[model samples]
Target: MNQHLRRLAFACTLFYTAAFASASQEKAKAPDAPAATRSRTLVIEPFMRVTNSSPTVVELQIALRKFTAPGGKGPAVWLSAVSHIGETNYYGALQKHLDAQALVLFEGVQARASTNAPAPEAARGAPTKEPAATQPAAPAKAAAPPDKSAKQTSIQHTLAESLGLVFQLEAIDYKRATFRNSDLSIQELQKIMEGDPDDPADASPAKKNEQLDRLVKVMDGSSFVGKMFAGVIQIIGTSPRLQGLTRLALIETLGQIRGDITQMNGLPPDMQTLMKVLIVERNRAVMKDLKSELEKAEPAKSISIFYGAGHMEDFERRLRRELKLEPGETLWLPAFSVDLQKAGLSKFETEMIRGMVKKQMEVILP
Candidate 1:
């Protein structure tokens, strides 16, 4: 296998899984003040990413409609981070709680299939066109065609259906946002690796070839480590006893994302550069799109941006410093539950595990 291609694949696997992963702080309650005096909520939460095989955990989220603006009844906005894969029950629940006219905006949305494309002739053809003999003696009734309008259901669309809300289809296209493509290009990367004293960014074919060879060697060595780490993270995130501790670990790991490439032990500098490009630059781009959406939104509307927990710190700071939006409430939703009954742990053992989690959190935070 080409080392460069293998490295790209490995990095993408890790990025897809970790992209939606987030950490949560202890849950907090909304104020008990009257609706007339209540401030609109800007929810900040961490979420654990899930797949079909993983145990379903609580999805930490903020529904802006929950914080109604006083004397201002209208739709709220939900800005989300995850890409649209398929339909799920979670979006259904969210739709039930939002305003009828609310809007849900998602980040990194793909360019939609063209609406103007010619409709299929088969769709318009009569079902009973064939002759009686040509069709079987007792022709089976053809099944109803699937609804094309509802085919591409992202979290936004699913929620929109129940909420009677509209979606502002303005997210960046998925092609431009992938792990390898979103970051610095290979040629640019080669220039950085081959720094010059007079012209630090000077590029040459020899230097490019040299850098490519080095990258190939480095990727071959690190592929196993990357895969192993990704598997370990997923396991810890789903296990009953270690899930909480895993949150703390993820927070610590993502927190150091801004550090220099030299600090990334074991991984090649090129790989480290790609990781930074994937996490940092991509997040900033998401934030920029979100800011644009917010500006276009109507004033006094309650709006929420549902993103990964690691992003909350930077986003919150930006909102406060640049946009003047302050968080009014924050909460935690458990991604999954530990069933002691299923695990068959003694009460003493359960207490011991809880104590250990608390201790680990204390050490990891502050």
Candidate 2:
């Protein structure tokens, strides 16, 4: 299989477990430094001023964890133990980090229902004068267009909704904006998969699976190898010994996205290039827009760049090296947790399961 496809498959498997469980910041002050040195402070740093009044700007990086509380709402973790931040505290701090007057930027396109009305006339507020009764009846309003925003959804939006939390940046009172609007929509990505000449999109679903099967067999030198690995995980997960364990302890259960995700460095060069297009380039656009906003924002106002966790490392590098912003003190929010102790499993059983899970993770993660 193509390395990208293999990685894709691993991700898909995790999603399946998610459905089963689906119902289931710090700061420091610094003394004034030289102009060039001051330029190196983080956006949140007091010394980092977009204007003389000194508006604080910061970025909040997030990963998806359950939005509901830990009682059977969906997949979750023990707040403090795993990722070190709890769900409630995570959202609470996020709200606190976002100041009232700051502009909030999100990673999505601004969408609204399509309409035929003239832009100027609608934006002008009440018409200056009522049109004469004789004026030709405005062409019967084309069946009022459907609400476009209603239909449009992004991963970020969906995840937030699932958690029953909303970003202040997304609030009507806030000046919400998107750093880049030219991202590939879901339909566009689907088209790419369908249009690839080697693997035409028009194939029947069964045929596509057959093709994928053949590809995997060739790539791994045995069609059964992938199934065997999955079977091992399934056995480890469902064994009676593990019955008392929480869903989080299941070897293949989803929502275990913890630890450093730096393994992208091990991917083939071509795969790396693909990821750069998917992630890094989008961030460059974000930084470009951010620079413009910083220059224009009112002094003493704050700004928040809320984006995925994966983007932060690269963004911080760009901030310090390119934008002359230095890293400030760190804050950790509990995003996901799996309370093995709560599952009532014995220490010996937990260790055995952890060993199996770790072995499987090692095999697939890199």
TM-score of each: 0.39, 0.42
Instruction: Please give, for residues 94-183, the per-residue lDDT of candidate 1 as tens digits.
Output: 333222323322222111112321122221111213345655565444212222343233222322222222222222221111111111
Per-residue alpha-carbon lDDT of candidate 2 for residues 1-366, written as tens digits (9 for 90 to 100): 233332332343343222111100101112235687656644421111111111211112233221112233321111111111124555565545443323434333122112332232131111112336633455222112212343223222233333233322243222222111212222232333344343333454345444434432322224464444333334323333232232333222223333223232244443322233334334544555556655653422444455544344345545545544434334444343334444444557545544554555565343
State the displacement of the C-alpha of residue 142, model 1, in Å, after optimal TM-score superposition: 32
Residue pair clashes in candidate 1: 57-335, 57-336, 58-334, 58-335, 58-336
Cα lDDT listed for each candidate:
0.33, 0.33
Q: How many backbone clashes does candidate 1 have?
A: 5
lDDT for 184 (candidate 1)? 23
**lDDT, residue 117, candidate 2:** 25
